[model samples]
Target: MLLVMTGIAAFPWPAATAQQKGGFRKLAPGVLTVIPPDKSSADELLHGDLLEVTEGLSGPPENLAWEPQRSPANTTLVERARNRSFARDIWCLEFAFKPPRMIEVDVPAADLKMQRKRVWYLVYRVKNTGGRRTVVDKDDPTKFKTETFETPVRFIPHFVLESLEPLSDAEELAKYRAYLDRVVPTAMEAIQRREDPRQRFYNSAEMVAKEIAFGEERWGVAVWTDVDPRIDFFSIYASGLTNSIRWRKRQGAVINPNDIPGSDMEVAMESLRLDFWLPAAGGNAAEQEMSVGYRGMFERMTLGSRVLEATGWPKTTKSNPAAALERMGLKWGDLLEPVGGGGPSMQPLEKVLTTIAGLKDPAIRTALVREMFGDVGEAALESLAAAAAGPVDTEQDKRRRAALQTMGLTPEQVAKDPYKSLARIVGAMDSQPGYAQRQAMAFKCFGPAGRRLEWLSKGAKAARALAAMESIAIDPNSVATGNAQTAFEAVRPSISALADEAERRKVLQGVFGPRGPDLFAAAVAVHEGIDHDWVFRYESDGPGL
Candidate 1:
């Protein structure tokens, strides 16, 4: 009996094993299943908290009867609040995302034909970091209460891959292209193998309606195809991260008492907005910095260089106004304040030359030299010459100087002989490359006309012409007067000498002569079509986004 008992005790029962040994339910006798280990604590983590700190009760208020219908004679639809807003600080989750990558996969089309398509995908993980907060109970908005049990997070993610290239600063809506997250069944297996075969990846819709409980994590990939490969900068808006929103009355939206108050308000989801710049290189995004050095302080950024870099958005520290507004759940046009304060309060550019032509001002024919070099003077001449010489390097002269310095040229060489000094180092860009730095050096110095204009000492043209132009802008009707004819007559001759040859005759005929605003209009139009708002695009292979 003792030997039988000993044998019975020694017999291994998989079902009877403790969870510490294996799983709570064993798969086999004497063989226990081990769960994969968690990621190493030592691994460098990109930490982002999706928990929103919430305050203020938005949406329709409880007891919302602005006008109650007490009788059938005054029949009205009873309004129950559609849904009470959650007054809880949005529960934050730990979020990590992988930069978008290109993967060529055998995508089976609707026709069931095996077609290889290019796919771009962003991989991300969300881990629930559970916490309790004293929040407003939805049942009674008036009463503030605390809840012990944290609500299960249902992640219904909306991933939008918006091309920054399309919304390139008020670019017309027609050229604006954006792609929604796609459901590509074929790409998953391939992405899994490429990223990590062990971890299961969920698509946008696949990950929906599932509760990620405390300490639980879910991984998902936002997939897109047919995206423009030429995009230099783009933002992948990951919404549904938090349920909190900040709203304000939409500009020019009128509020109706019968409608929900929120309907009149424009709402912005609290989301992770990540901005990326892709250099000309195939697979990298560059970081933005003061490209022209602010000495070594901003030297953290390479001068005149663009290196694409990825950034995290969820840190809670007080940030710059732009990011802070976003963190506080604000979007563009929320407050509707004019940017840069409507610029300077300068008056309209006058039709002085036109008025002069209508009068056929004869006094101005005195001498071309006197009109060009005397009355208009050196200061105004310089302004006209610089303006005519096709937008001299006004903003980047410093950057060009720095570029020259980077090219082993002294400050004196950069100032006195920028053009030739820049030439000596043109080849050095490839040998010792700093693109932005080198590109800054590449900025051509002011031309001969521009150089000559500077000889007027600070007064590019004499002060009198400039004084007339400046003061004329002060009075709305100044251009329509006899003084306007004389003033314009004096400034007209200078354009022949100063304006770009392509537009000089046009200006001389239209703006300076009997052509009036017509030819001057054409002369000005010569520069109108140029997309001066330029970004020198470049590309690189790795160490990108």
Candidate 2:
């Protein structure tokens, strides 16, 4: 049992020769070693570490070798994996940067030279382990069964290094120390700025891999959450320069694919240092944040949700999600038991169903329904055939009559396949420019023409309501002022008649950004002929519905 403990106490070891594994030239007097998962004596990497230290690149005019000192802290074991396929228990190494020390790099402009120092170390390797677990089947009571499973324990660490130059001067050192006292927030903000764009909840790194240039150096860190359900914690650094230094994690997969040729993964990060000169007393110092955590973080990643803001999806009560279903006009009793015992208690309506039903324009809906659902939505339209025979009085009715007339179908032909007949009826109604005109006409209608559309067939009702919705422009203000009132009146009836309240509410949820359910209720009130007072009341209070 390799119990990988962590500590910062330094120790010395006997001199060793640099071992070579293809392009990974292992450093002598090594800090750590990696045994390949294959467990082959030929495949074992001798006394060395996993940093691809590149030197003598053309940019710096003169670049000296990064002479690595064995980090003062002993290598802490961050994870242990038993790969039965390789028949080996692999221990992943982690350690922190020793004290920051100076390195010399000559710059070209004006022969200017600056003393620079960096503290770089591998943090931890986030990994998912899979194996077969043998358990007695509770169902059979005495039967033993083996099940294969995978556990996702995502170990995410952010490496931060702050360096200020000219340590030879006591005043410069004092300024650097004082600056460290104030650099926490600034350093945090810098890290946040880089990570925010990449810090999304993705199961696999592949999702964001396209967002980043593969194998090219980037300035930010890439982040991913465990695809599986697990509680992951991150260390919160305290105010001091070394207030809380935890065990280091492996940077990431290697940067140069050629380095570890044919290896499935590479080091995730290449650089883990940030350098900033202290401000000249009152004047601010130029701070440069350097990072490598973004690279190789996406390898072997499973795709998952990319949640940027919790505000977008507010958590509702889970005790009775069925209540929400009831509110959506679906009876709780009607819902089939979820196939899995421990999933959501209520079966949510298919998004497509609500999308088809809540659409703001009948013409668009007709087109989409025909294209997307095809024969699938035919059953839902079965009941509408009877409505086609109902009296045609209002302009909405005349429009339906025009649609049926265009189909040129006899009553005998309509009765044989009611759903198909209804689909054809709507499809025919959609063929004319008058379909769109009537929708807009209903939107502008202040009298019975708009109100009477409620009695039309479900398809016509949905279309007319959608057309009204299209008429009103989105308004950010809660009060029904200016064009907001027109927009509200247009969508009011469509939303009210929608069987799915959540879908109804979503129509206004982000109509102009995060207005929430109140806007939906206000629209409903306008449709109900209550007008300004109720709409204002809904806006002032929360969504009363």
Candidate 3:
């Protein structure tokens, strides 16, 4: 028989033997001593009506190694002597089982109607060491820094048992062996992956806790009787190992009491907690019935006193009388107060205008607009164009305008179409210093829809003008086929006009490539009609080049 009783106790020093007791035998500086009930005289000590200390700092050392050769492991205790070796005069306590319990058993039934099976149980205990409090000061030795201390530890006793019964049929038994062969290697691989000792310990604890409570009382025996003839016993055990690891990994990730709550901490904790328990007992398991109970208890016991008091909902504190007049959803600059005299607090909605109007800092304004209106359509585009035309000399404004034009609106199109509200702002780009940039923007926008090529082609400087023509010809969806043909016709006369072969090849490739085959063919015809000494190389890797 194995019996173990472990707890903490403390007592006052006797005046006569005070010197012999070693002056309170400091467990900690102000903390004093921790005494344990005599292990040999436990029976007499209990009957002595001695003051039983339910809680204290003395039980076992905090750090101890388990020796396998020792018997009745619970009886082994390790302790550290009080000295100046520690920063705060702390001591460690450790307990271990020397002769580990043999918990695996095979039972035989005398009657044919009774079932025979194997049962396994693993038993272990954990001891929690209380933390300490201290005071220290760097600048002033007299003025000490005070620290509150408490042990945030709990001891848990655990046992696990698994019952295995042989299959009644030969076919099912063979299938079970085959399944085990395939799964045992994978189970070993998972076990090898858990490198942390704490992880391994916690996993073992969770399994023992779960197996001991399966389908009986919260703490009771698990039995498999009148065994099913078809169930594969080995496969069930093999798969259980894999499932147990998954359960442990998930449990380890949950937020315990050691975690501090933040603004979203509760929500995150609840989510992880729920996720952890979902596979166990199928999501509706009671708190007491799940692994979270022990973890939750530890958290509440340690940190519950420090939890912040909940306050009622906040009352609005704005003192301005006009604040009450503001609409609930009205944004910061949505004209909540009248713009001039009493018209409406806000303007009539036509489009989604960005509120960052006339912002002096272009980068700040662009960022604000992007934040508020990146998802808005034409109104945001018009507002950005207007901002670009403002006095601010910001590169962001130039980029915004370029982006707007690339989105497909020419100044003329904006002027003539129903979306002509921002016509003046769109037209202003033509006269801006970034004319080449504007022309490129116009080509990108108009070329795709085949509508604004004429305006793009009529642009300012020679270099920009040629580049605009190239942009239009390369557009896959360019609608101005005739204008594209005309531009190619105009460039054909200068193909061999004493220019570099690379530039000529580039132009030829652009016209003849995938983007504009018709234009390329037209250029070829014009070249052939002039009987120029131009050689076109066409390579065929297949039947059709």
Candidate 4:
């Protein structure tokens, strides 16, 4: 069903008298596409009206004496054939997206009954912005001009979901699952109800390959089913939204006509790549916030999550390891269960503290602390890294230092020569990243028998337990507010009390900042462009599970 009511607009056709922001636009001179009928010609593909080819360009000039690789045997079909009167077509659509969301909707089944399914969907809006581009002028065919014109643009949307989780190079190479967009007939209506009932939304297929004229905007939703809820990180490659492309011609004595555009010929489609991170994915997880990121940012996040998970840091910190990472603005998560258990046991805080206090030797205490905090050993080893910084000039030193600062080097591998090593310089940090969070948390000591200790106490649970019992909640305003009943109470009332509302929160927070549901409502708001959702799930990271 074409839910979009294609109506005749007020703005005149392509080239109107005046151009308004959200109105119909006019086509400039030479606005027509020049993609010829025959695409089999490699020459045509390589150099269109835009006969642009980059070879040994870009990058800053460097002082070096090295032999450039020359494949003298390699030759091109048309060695010295050239044509001018060209221009590059780089038309773009204004694209913006909301974070991916899941909607439980009913779908038509084989037996004709409606089967409810969980569909993961992304919502985005695209508008033809009447962009400027260099084109061969119609008036003078030899000359070129940059004009802003809104031409008819047909959107043939192609969306592919790519997992960005890094395991090992080999495992990661084959570890990902690329999910293609699906046409879920049943999902459209359900998504609309969940999103905006007033607006019309189209799926990848339903979006007619018809020209979306200038001044018009379209909303689309690409959906997928059977997406791994266990997916920690991924990127959505949205293609066909724009008709822009870039290519690197195979440089040689001759352009081989038989050459497949794989290694040598680089044809890069201009697509919108959107990265997202689902911090928590499994059934045991909570509020799986789908965070938006640039390309590869999610990989760092997953690495943090996985590393902490492997170390069982959440258990040590007595807080949700995932939540800890988010609170500290660290892109991270801890989420995997590799079968079969028995590992070295972590000593409880009380036991560790007792043993530490009893140890007389300073060296042994230091070693034990190092054992408890592996970053200490890491810090020690990192102290000696400068010794390897042999003979190097200022440029090399600056380059190497920048590479060293990468947290797994997003794009930081310096090359003095043909140093073929994509390998990163992995070292240890002197201190863990999230160690110094000065933010105050609502804390309460629930007496001696161990408080889960809820907070990261570093063996201070014994003291917290003592404090919980000795502490009493009192309000002098009970008499003034006519709630004198609190004074008459024997134990001064439980944590939830007469003055609870005034103070405003948990017995912990009520005594401290008066403060602050859920995943679904937040997900809905995210679609509407209000991206806000962060919650500390546990009432109290207190005593028991």
Candidate 5:
């Protein structure tokens, strides 16, 4: 990552009689020596043998003995040649710098002392040193080689300038600003025109060392002229005056590993802050940087049709809610029948008889049916009597006849007033193996508008019973908003009486779990009605609450 240019000891100027012959010589492992082809090429030479070094070191040998040549123009000429011929190993050229001279460098007062009159030019070189060929057989303009087995190389430049003085007058400051504006655009143009694929997206970042002045820090302005526009990069102003540079060095990039996907947004915003805002603030502003990171992520997730397919969710359609419900295998009556009984309902009353009847778990079914259906309902009573009177010997048929007998309901009575006879069937649900089934059935009959609130008020003690009542009130298809509000009012007192947090949570779950949107609003209202702090605390607990 270093570039070095040094003056070498003068060597004897060769005569015309000397023969010219030069080629590469391996001086050491990975080191090579380059000899000038003729004595004329060697005359007043700053470098006699070119030495190849590795990356990471800073400069070349200090004093190799050679005959001294005596001429000023010759000295200048030799210096330029040394600068050109003193190339480092191409692989190691991550950074390059122009050697420091005794010239003056403008910088800010804070950075004035630290600024050095040295400028460095560097290009990040990615070299293909492997013997294998690439999978894609195409020429890469950014690269030096494109053929299979050819060594590919691309360069990204870096320029470093040290020790600058601040501008002394307004005119100088304006000139410096204008200069920067011109240089940045020019550098971006060069990057855009680069044909190398590897260099096409390369970005440039400038570091103005501590010694540079805000007004006079023009030491490294031209370096900004050669950067690629497409590459996203930023510059850091290292102010030496107030120890800002020290702080930056200590902080480095404040990355938190725990932040994960979201933190990358923070990093990008930080870069943007340094590039656009730091200069105006003199490097000490404390405002938090704003970013589009999460917003952008959300946009990508929701806006595009492709993301929906990727996540296994169906694309949203403009069809109305009724159409969507039908697609889900639901119908209007299925949601509304528990409140009224004026007409013949759907034939699958067994399925709609109660939530308990639909349950696969016999134990839970027994618990639910027993608590909710205390006796056979008119619907169930009719179904049972019809099955019992029919000539049937199947185990299911026997079970039905035994259920009617246990409930003290004869086949004739069951048929005469099946709905009225529901009381006895519900009572049988509370006995032995049917309790769970009764509870489940109660859940099923709790739909909105189909059943009367007066009937529900009778069994509002059990959490599941209260839940069914509320379910009927909040059914989306029902005109039971008044009933739902009344139910909420009725249940709140019972829920408040619960002594244990766990029991209260269970009641709340039943209320809110089945009718989420309605209950959410009710809960929020209750929380606010008592204390504003409660509302804040509940929301702050996040979705986990």
Candidate 6:
């Protein structure tokens, strides 16, 4: 049995006594390599050289080996690191198995109900390690910083098997041989046909949508730079891996985290590359440092299949807020205060009614009305009906009006509401004579002269004159203003097919003098509430027409 230790303080390593410990080796000032204590049971199949602690380091030392040592109480190992400017300290507390032994079972055939693979497990405990308080920038809300102490734990490996244990019993050996014979060739063929795990890793839903959760089912790699630990803005990923070699390669072109994905196994894996990160507006000082140098630390834990299954670490199940609310028969409006507080509320009623209109599910809307308002449902319904009865003058109405006008429509035919406007436009287009009449009606409603008056009201005399002329050409009856003759004379030549360019210019100049175009532009700009300088500014070509 593996020895259990407890209640240890930070930084327990002394340089002189380090070598005497079973298999603790110092790789760097604050980094140490730990090995399992039961050396006899550990074996070569474990790939000792590829142990996570030694290989996962940023720059590991060459030509160093160590034996596994039973940890003293609480802390498994503590290492102290220092450079010219700062110091780092790591404290490791291990939670080893109760038995600290492997299960002995004959290898199962591939066709067996229980198919097993030799997969290693690792765990990481990432925390804020932020300062006592946070500092916000006065000028910029997005920029902020924090103070942090205590060096982050760099590398902790749960596995450093000392040696391999082989099947020695005759019956066990026979079973192992038979299992291999039955499975190896099939396994090789399957491997050849299977899609590349790397492709799946990159294309995984979790990878594309970098969402991480901090819950019981978290597996794989979780990295969060800006995390507020106090509010639980931290993410976790749990994964089973033989080593970190592949993960290290995949870490670049890093997909930044937005929110936590609710599901695990979104990405398929030969060895899981589960990844997600929690986000906060601001980041911890230590995390910032680690992120800058790609130097974050993670925890590693080895677990037997049975132990993992018992702990419920197999897959992540994401929670659905909408479904949850539905199951509770609750609406968002129910949680919000009324439009006007203290007495009866209108806001929730308004929101709930509006939302209900679009929902297809009868129960969704019914439950919203019955459950959300209950006693006040009648009052809410009355208010909603009143609001719906009023004139259609919303932003949507304005957009529909503008759209119909753009498509050569008049108010008479294109009534209020998108459905009516769409129907009118479609009806007008279905018959050529109806389309021509609609066009004529549009011209008559705001023919060139009337359009000119509108522009002048907005301060665009030249544009008004030009538009007024075009309208008259489309429909002679469009000129209905008191200055009808003057307006007609202004654009008469431009309307005539026999008029030349010079004749049109003379008519335009007579209606609006040489400076008319410039003044009209300024007037239009002012009417629209746009910057006058932007309207008048000249580009490389010239002032825009």
TM-scores of the candidates in the order shown: 0.38, 0.17, 0.15, 0.41, 0.18, 0.17
- Report the lDDT tens digits of candidate 3 across residue range 182-219: 11222222322422222223323233443221111111
Best by TM-score: 4
Candidate 4 TM-score to native: 0.41
Per-residue lDDT tens digits of candidate 2, residues 140-203? 9567555543221122333322221113211110111111111122233333343243332221
Count clashing residue pairs in model 4.
8
Off by over 4 Å in 5: 1-385, 388-393, 410-413, 416-420, 430-436, 439-522, 525-545
What is the RMSD, in Å, between candidate 1 and the native fold over all Cα? Answer: 24.4
What shift in Å separates residue 431 of candidate 6 from its native position after superposition? 32
lDDT by residue (tens digit), candidate 5, 167-192: 22111101112112222333333333
TM-score of 2: 0.17
lDDT of 6 by residue, 328-364 (tens): 4444324232121222112222333344455567666
Model 4 residue 96 lDDT score: 57
Residues 1-545 of candidate 1: C-alpha lDDT, one tens digit per residue: 12322342243422221111212221235221111212222111112111110111222443333445575422222222222233233454556665566778888778979888777787777766543335556999777554433445667887776652322211211133578899898888888887777777899888885667656767789898887866644556667665444444456654444554345445454555544444345333212110110111111111001000000001111112223223333332232212222111001001111221233334542222222234443244333323333334655445434554555765465444332332344334323333333233333333333333222211211121223222223221233234322333334445534546744443332221222223233223323222111011112211111
After superposition, the stretches of candidate 2 with alpha carbons farther than 4 Å from their true spots are 1-94, 97-324, 327-545
- lDDT value for model 6: 0.25
In model 6, where is the ten-residue run with the lowest total lDDT?
A: 292-301
Best by lDDT: 4
Clash total of candidate 3: 12
Candidate lDDT scores, in order, read: 0.40, 0.27, 0.25, 0.41, 0.27, 0.25
